[model samples]
Target: MPIKGSSKGIVGRVGSLRGLSTALMLGVALLLVGPVAAEDFPLRDKYASVGVPPVETGELAGSLDAMTVVDARSPYEYETLHIRDAVSIPLASRDFNESVRTLAEESGQPLVFYCNGVTCAVSYKAALKAKKVGVKDARVYDAGVFTWAQTHPEHTVLLGEPLQSTDQLIADEAFKDRLLDEDGFYARIQSSTDPVIVDIRSQDQRQGVSLFQMKDRHVPLTNDNRELGGLVQAAMNEQRPMFFVDATGKQVRWLQYYLDEQGVEEYWFLEGGASKIYEGMGLQ
Candidate 1:
């Protein structure tokens, strides 16, 4: 099993607290390679423990046709951005395994499934599922679409357009600009005359319990994004400052592209998203 990103696990802590600031800076630089580090997301460990191997990003980059690349994320995410020539076969579909089988048989190529990044378990799970269904070679590209897009713009697509320059992709700094902690989110609500909050959680994720007492408008970026389109249009039309929260804050990365593309000027995302907000709320 070859893992590319963060190939080496953290070996050990510093023996002494000497030069701690420099060490901390180096660690921060390493971890920020993605939205979050693999250590923070245990699902990567969970799948790897069960025997799913990750295809190195550079290996895939060197040989794009070595395997049939599959986007294990939702079609919406795929539509927003994806590796050029990668097929979208979201893991949630009823015939996911069957679809993998068809592609494998037709192309006679190994399969590599990838979603958001280290935070996402979909790609790992998708590969495991493919193996269970007897696909010859199934692997994961756990580094995912974001890294791929940034790594090779020539191999990237954004909003149905070939990404001509890396500048077209959103920068980490740009995303950081709109990202807010729980306190910042609360401050925005408290300071606003009429805070237009938005909950982007999926219906199933909400579990029929409103995170914001059903007050915040619910508009998720699902496969069918008509509702989300309406919300974006309204936000653009009204020039309202909307605060958005998702299940785990990862979705907002994808949503931000849409928001920025739509020219929505004022918006903020709740870091750690609805999950953290719930914990902050101290609800049962």
Candidate 2:
């Protein structure tokens, strides 16, 4: 959620504007998603603006079975939770286009791709790539897994079981508790008890240099909770507060579930991930 009137999700920060390209993409996508008023947000900046219309219930009403709903997120995210009958084709994979072609050719159905929400660009980017690779029947579901699983729990699965409650997602307050701006983050680093700073960006997203040269641990973020559990265990064993950074802050939202599940209470997420250090992410 961006501050009441601004496109950026955080409060009181100035940086280079991401508005130009974002606005242009949304202008093109709105024609597909349906008519929108100035007030209809998330569409505006609640998530990444895409050059394609995102799928919603109206688009799939009676044809959900006819269309292939592809999860363009990581395997770990898919394993954690996903729409029923959806197939995973991570956009990050090297064979992403070939995989999409194989599935599209095999199924011969319209492909509806989705990811972490409008907040993330994986789904839309996947659709664009599929189209570029000549898969014309591709589409995007930018609303993301969190929204679908919450509103349609019966059609969702969590940890290999049918999802039971909307509670599976982290609450806003819980997320807020772990969120820290650059200033607050740096301030805490000066504490007598040194905190553990972990970088959870994937290999591709790592810009090839450390943000915290003195003590930054590289721990790539994955949906496979086990790796994260290992970090949590280490933090607990050493009695250290953990600080995690991702490409964008959105990933930590899902990772929070693993942290809570493992009983790791003291942790913080970079407000907009490390990208915020260079430029505000998510619709700045």
Candidate 3:
């Protein structure tokens, strides 16, 4: 079924497939001249995984002993309920920087960042700020408090914090894996009102690419299709929706995790990399 948004011409549809099939989900809205045909669509029955490098649940359990786990949720959210020992440093607060700096100086341990949930980007923003302040290790717990609630129900959760378990999120029939389809990617782009589409390719690679003849503003993530931090930041600034088109699913997935940490709610990547988008345009 197609989900409608505020845009002029865009539609998102998740197919009728069922039961834990690892199909990458791509939600795209397109305005094409003719009855557009999607060829070589990347989305299939293959699951696409997301989020931060696995923090050993054991490591996470042990982390509470010697490390400071900072919750980047707002004060109201914090006061309602929170995990045991999780300090509040709302990303929206004026004192966020100061609080983080003070913690870094006093504690002398790497800071672990978390936000409300997987879709929330607060922890990623917190981690970026922590890195700037010279905190040696600023790891983002991408799952955030929601996932934490699922995995560690024994831990105290802040009152009013919405709870959606890991099983619920992962098994969520609606959870769309971004690595799946060409049309799905377009649906994601259509969802955003004014998305900053980032082409995370090298200068040379970008020069060699084109997206549906609908030229989008692109920022090179590397000189030779390498590091992706620049593109990551560009996507993070988007207030509406954002899209990152890369050379491979691997890099795009990483970018999604980074964006997730920043608390970006709506975001996506072009499936089959940049070339696939072009190929659909009949451009090789």
Best by TM-score: 1
Better of 1 and 2 by lDDT: 1
| Per-residue lDDT over 168-266 for candidate 1, one digit per residue giving the tens place of the 0 to 100 score | 655577777898999888888778756678888878777777666777887766544567778767766777688898998777877776666566788
Model 3 lDDT at residue 204 = 59
lDDT of 2 by residue, 22-119 (tens): 10001112222456444433543433344455567556545777888877776656666767777767787677777778778877888898886555
**Order of models, best TM-score first:** 1, 2, 3
lDDT by residue (tens digit), candidate 3, 67-92: 66777764433433356567666676
For every candidate in turn, the CA RMSD to the true structure comes to 11.8, 11.7, 17.7
True-vs-predicted CA distance for residue 177, candidate 3, Å? 24
TM-score to true structure, per model: 0.78, 0.76, 0.38
Order by lDDT, highest first: 1, 2, 3
What TM-score quantifies how close candidate 3 is to the native fold?
A: 0.38
Candidate 3: regions farther than 4 A off: 1-56, 160-284
Model 2 weakest 10-residue run by lDDT = 18-27
